[model samples]
Target: MGKERDGAGQVRPTTSLSPSAEFPPLSAQDIETLRRLGEQWRVEKPARALPVDPELRPSRPGAARARGPDEAFRPDQPGELTATPAAERPDTSRGRFALRVRRVLLGPPLSSMSMLRERMRKLIALPVLSSDLLSSVAYGPEALLTILVLAGSAALGLSLPIAAALVVLMLAVGASYRQTVRAYPHGAGSYLVASDSIGPRAGLTAAVGLILDYVLTVSVSVAAGIAAITSALPALNPLSVPLSLAVIAALLAGNLRGIRVAGNIFAAPTYLFLVAIGGMTLFGLGQAVARGFTVIPPPPVPATEAISVLLIARAFASGATSMTGIEAVSNAIPALRPVEWRNARTLLTWMISILILLFVGLMLLTHLNGLVPRANETLLSQLAHRTFPHGPWYPIIQAATALVLLLAANTAYNDLPRLLYYMARDAYVPRRFLHMGDRLALTNGLVALSVAAAVILTAFRGRTQALIPLFAVGVFLAFTLSQVGMVNHWRRHRGSGWRRRAAINALGATLSAIVLVTAAITKFASGAWVVVVAVPTLVLLCLGIRRHYDRVRQAVSLHPTPTQLTSAERSEREMAQEFLPQRVHHLLVVPVARFDQAALRALAYVVSLGQPALAVHVSPEDQEADRLRDEWTAWGDHVRLETVVSPHREILEPLAQYIAQLRERQPDITLTVVIPEVVVNRPWQRFLHSQIERRLRRALRRLPGVVVTSMPIHLSEVHPQATR
Candidate 1:
């Protein structure tokens, strides 16, 4: 055997002249037969051709059963060969599986400062965060208004005073949350606070409440804001609910784009809305004080019918909604710059300052501008017209305030997903919720929240008051539990120097819990049942999450010992034995018409491997057979040629039978079937020739004791080397 090159400078097949017969160069008809054989037996193993007859070889008694050689075997039938290995036994070790998981999720060091910065920016801008925060501002007033409604407008004179008190309470809560930001700065807010202070169950409960509140905040606020806009611009009146839903959709899409895009998009509106509300509050206050106004009133506000003292307490409890997003700064403390605690406190101050101004300013403007509260109209819109001196600023202020309220709901877009991401990491929610899209945003959570909020908005027709009482109750429940959890947390950790601080938290928890009960009872009839329902739902969900974690933990646990790698190695070794070594004598059956560059290449590869090769072709008639024989004699040079005549004009059957006869004469000879195959580079080109390849492979697979190899030529796969 000598080194040979195909047309492509790769391996090509050659033939050895039979000792007693001559060889032939393949013609067009001979090549066609070769191509058909190659197609049919492409997947079949070629038989190793040998010079010595198998019947002459001495057979051992036990080797018959051990080697499993059957006398009935045919080279064309692949299934007759018992050379393949058994299946690999699976390893069931937990440590090995865990190593695999780690290799996949946490690969080679790919992190850099730029990547970390990018991830941080993206997480901060997540749509869930924006939607979560903004949603709070929308319903923030409803709780206050409902409280005044139950307590009566006579107590409404005290609404500002009560709001002032609520502001103080909100400040305390905010301060306490600052500690949370410093301690568990994961943007998970209340869940972290409760989980660290109490346990995972407590944490999950807080998470569920926070999530529900975040969702409702988006729905309720958008609905109410739309209503406010409608009150100012009546022409947009028809689309109030749908338009609110539209805003939700747009925000959701923005979030899906990625966190950074959403953050940058929402950040401006969020701050602008904040400034607008702050500006309105100060402008209204300066105007009221400058005008020497003594609380102008258009009419007497309505009084609820002989409300119980408990009702009065319940009504007061509703105002706590003003504190809905009080913990947001703490929740998102991680999004701040370094020196997170100091930055958080400053941010807290800024947020609280703006919140206080908006709450007091809106209420005071309504009172000072003779803007009476109505069942449907916004006090802010009425105040905008009355307090702004009735000029161009009137429409602008009205629009600005409405826009501010709408944009406030965008905060929910940021908060909800961040919190859910944490919950998902803890295995409390579906892992999908933790997925970040290509844009590095929690797109799944954003879409889920958006759809959920839209459903609520549609279901309730965007009524702010309808969703109001339900809002703060769940939040305050978390607040109360968190406060109590903190008190316990502090007590357990405190030394001699912290006794006073512990007492203060104890008092705070005691007071908040009492207020929680009062609010729950007083607001129950006024749609507070929604919060009541939320608590149990959240509890059940947490329990379910715990169950899932436990189940997964149990499923993949490791055993004491593992089996060795003996079986697997043996199986692969047996599979490799089916292939024949080079230097084997064999008859090369080449269908001449099929003998394209691919066939020639395959023949070159087989012959270079030192196998004795022959060319086989079919003849249709006596004259054609004689002509083929003459052509074979002329092309023989050194190789032998064999010809088969088909009487019924069937190709595969006759060719298959000819290979069978050769296998019987020399069982050790490997019959190398040279098939020319077209290699297509493009996807569409594959559709053209795939069917013929499939049919050929299927028929050849049934042949026994044969190994088949396919040699593909680049017809269209490569353009004939680009001529310079």
Candidate 2:
């Protein structure tokens, strides 16, 4: 593959032709033409020179000329190709104070050339991408128990069976995504897959669902981490909301530093949590084996709800939250190093293995030790306390669990911005979301995710139980759509082993759909309705934004045929004619507020253009208009003057009406509205005067065949002899 620049100045990948492909032989005339063009290019190319200070250069006919403030308005002149030395350039750093602060918060900016260096190897990618799936082991079994315990102690025995079912779902979904990586190595995000295989509406629906899922992942993961902290230290219970928000802010700062820095910072906690949980599960199982693998009965409590099919279904739905982040690896394949799809598949397998071992091991240990969910403490904390009753292992386990859970929101942060970038590229969101910051990270999307998560965490008061009901619905909905789309993809482009791939995805889709419907129906009244309503509304909003962009593109696009030309095309053609001075027909209209040095300078520049010039003024009283006319006469009447007297004291309205009339009378001629502006040196001095030029430009932008320009007269230039 090779890279080439498109017309829009973006780099895109192109495939090289095979060596065996046939090509036409070059003729003698074609070879001669190519040789001549190469010689001409070498002769025309400018010579390379070292930068020199403008002040140090000698004053000669062909010497480099210094640029004035007004030079930006004029076209570039030939033989002006000297580079400016850094020392003599204007001090632009004063205006970049905000950029400096961002640098402090997010480190120094990385160049776009360093994008490949930012990719993660499999070792680093595993923990960075699997944190959410791995951290869910801390809460997944507990969520299941919480729902089941409502039917009393008898329902606690059913936890093992429910956990086994969740494991199967995780394996199937993981396998399906592995196939997704192979099929769509570039990116297999749900929106892209569903939009390609299914229709655009289905793709948009999946995009909206995944967006909700990512936002809730951040809020819920932080809340759960805080829950673990308060469980270990009861003194911190009252500070849960504040603590959650603080953790979110920290994640935002770390991620804004770019992908490599974030991955390294967050890599350690996930491994620690895995080791701690893995050790606890092993120790607990060994102790149970010594005790003949007995099942200890849990403490008896009254049943709040009767055991039934509905109750079991709800428990299964809640436990399926463990499968939330399984699809992240497929969506973020590009973040991996070379051989991205293969590395992603290997990482997915490892994640599924670890998640299953921890999830199932914790459930079995809970059943053997007869532990139940408690309001004041988490189940993982309880298991750790029982497994290591006397040593420091319990605290170590709790600390690791809390840290990993807090950083699990990193997974959502990584994938959400990339998804937004894809959507923005397709015009589904604001174009600003497509911009990468100095660090090559999607800064707008990251900030948007942080604000949304903060609002949700505050509203729920950082309670994990309250947020769990709203969690898994969107993720499961996304999973079903993505898998179903893959099935269609395989059927359309069948190759070797295509039938096997389609069957695997079909099974995954069926299982995911069952969970999706179960979660939405069981948790609807609790909080799932919010997601149910939000997904469709967001889909419509995306479609509406796309429609608006389409209309704007059509209105501004140029056509090759003169009869089909748009206003923009005509304006561009007329602008080109400006260089042909003999054929140019333009009228200059200068809007004067009062007769001052700024207005006089603007009038002088307009008169120098040698075009028919007119000066217009709007006065609230008749006396003001009479005084302005007298001043123009005293100034030698360089240009014609037209004054309008208004009783309502409207400035922009009268100026706009006059310009519109000019355009109406001479429809074929271009009207240039030049306004003189006073440029203040100090920022605070700006509030002292009216900004009429700024407002007038906005008011006149809607008029056809009329161009607006500003002629600024600096305060220092107006009073050159004044003291600082």
Candidate 3:
């Protein structure tokens, strides 16, 4: 045995090979062949030397010497070249002004290594995740009352019973989701649960439902927040749509800054709203105690219609929108600190407890104070007035309510992007959604959610009532699917307490399905149909995207045996063989629209490549073709010229057909379409020139074994001497 130093200067033992063993010694011819192969490999892949900063280079005693640039240390071992450190490389892609604006809007970009630091602790996570569920109290009661009020004020008594039922539903869903977090610690939420336990279709259905719910959560939350603002000051009613959009944009900017920063920025308002509501509830109950629990008769108003079972069902369905954001914690378990499942479960429990208390407290106070839904003012606002009519607390509570409502969309902002990222990983959505931005955030998903929410808000004109009907259907659908999937999961993987877990999920599934059906049926005429149609359409879209990706994978995947190739695969294989390096051939074609300096430069570049080059011109008229040929002759005809006169005056189609013909005639050679494009400095100047190269490239890209490249000649570069 002998010792040899490894790449890192670690000594390792090496065993000597015995020539007498099975293998014979190398002959002179074998040694010469190995040497030639090594030389060829070296020629193909030369080692890249990195320049060491003179000040940073370490000095060795008795060997200290200044090194010239050419004498810099070169890596002798293969694949040992050091990459430039990220800290030393500055990205100059974005302009300074654009970067400044981005920094001002989104804060500084966070390194991916800082992901651990970005994870939320319980303090920040609770508010960040629970805002939507908590803030729903501001409008849940109003939606219920608004529906019941259509029948009469007498129907308003059903609010308490409906509220009680909603509390039970919230508990069941929250508990079921706790189990979900334990089961799926990595946090794909309903999509993962349904896909694994049920089927891919079920998972896609659940994902589409969650996606719609998230979009609606943003729109409805912002609209309700604006409603609160307008309720306080009716003068702002005309600007509701604009105000809602602005709030959404602000939320998008905040979240784009990354999770931790958003949590910090949004935490105060959630706590404030909780305190204001809790204090008001306690103070109102105290007043009720002083009055010996008297139920004040609400001021009489004319009944619009007779109260019936359907009216109560519609009210229940509408009020169920309160539970829209409940699944967020389960979906975002990965966003929590260590022991993510436990923290997520704990956070979920706290959210449900707070939500139940606030919701029930507000409902009881609304009854006790005899507050009804009004067009200009929210029920919570009316309750606030009754609780603290004479103090500054009314405005404070109103302000807190408004702020929390607007920011409540943060919950959707947090989970929707993650859910989309999971779907993208599964190839059900566009792959771009899987990418994290410079801030380590799912930027594409966030932007998509923002745009979708903005469109919905604008369509609904930022009216809370108008948007409420479309909200709960998607929410309860996702809940039902998730709970059902969990039930299946518990049954399949029966553990010690599996039966109990199965029972809990079964109860949640039953309740969620009832709510889902109720909402879909009662609110069908009132915009719920939009979500009904949208969900299936989105699901189909996702399936189509997946199918497309699968086909692409099948076509491009390398197979072990040729016998396994399908007919389509065989065709693809035949097309792929044309570009294989074993049969090297090249045909470089330059498409010349006109005989100008740009065309001359492109011809020169192609000729310099020393390949079989041809210059083709597509002219609408014979006179133009003749003129181009004459000009080519005068320019010394550096490359072969072939002009195709198109009497129909189609440029891209004729050129594409000509190239396809070339590829068909010589299927063995690879076609390289070198397009010469005019580069404009100013944005408006691009419109002045014909952008034929872009369209030509797009047309040529469809041909197999045809590579498209552009040689751009900037207007400034066209006349360098003139500029000087």
The residue-by-residue lDDT of candidate 2 on 1-724, one tens digit each, is 2122222223444211111111223445446644544443322235557576333444576866455642322224443432323222345566467666776899876766688888888888888889998998788888888889999999898888888888888878888888877777766378777877787788789888889988999998999999998998899999999999999999999999998999999999999998999999999999999999998889887799999988888899889897678888877888888887789889999999888888889889999999989889999998998899988999999999999999999999999987876666567888777677778777888999999999999999999889988887889888999999989998998989989989989988988898889889989999999999998999999989888876665444332234334534574345334334344468999999887777878898999877899999999999999998998888788789999998999888988998999889988778999999998998898889887778899999999888999999887677754322
By TM-score, how accurate is candidate 2?
A: 0.86
Candidate 3 displacement at residue 1 in angstroms: 47
- What TM-score does structure 3 among the candidates reach? 0.85
True lDDT of residue 537, candidate 1: 81
> Model 1, 417-512: lDDT tens per residue?
777666665566776776665445566778889888888888878887787767767677677767766666667777554565555556556656
lDDT, candidate 3, residue 609? 74
Model 2: worst 10 consecutive residues (lDDT sum): 14-23
**Could you estimate the TM-score for every candidate?**
0.60, 0.86, 0.85
The per-prediction tally of clashing pairs is 70, 0, 0
lDDT of each: 0.60, 0.82, 0.82
When 1 and 3 are scored with TM-score, the better candidate is: 3
Q: Which stretches of candidate 3 lie over 4 Å from their true place?
A: 1-94, 560-564, 568-579, 593-597, 619-638, 647-650, 719-724
- Full ranking by TM-score: 2, 3, 1
lDDT string, candidate 3, 34-76, tens digits? 5544443322235457566433444575665444443344344
Give me the runs in candidate 1 sitting further than 4 Å from their true place: 1-115, 119-143, 146-153, 291-293, 495-497, 559-724
> Which residue pairs clash within candidate 2?
none
Clashes of 1: 70
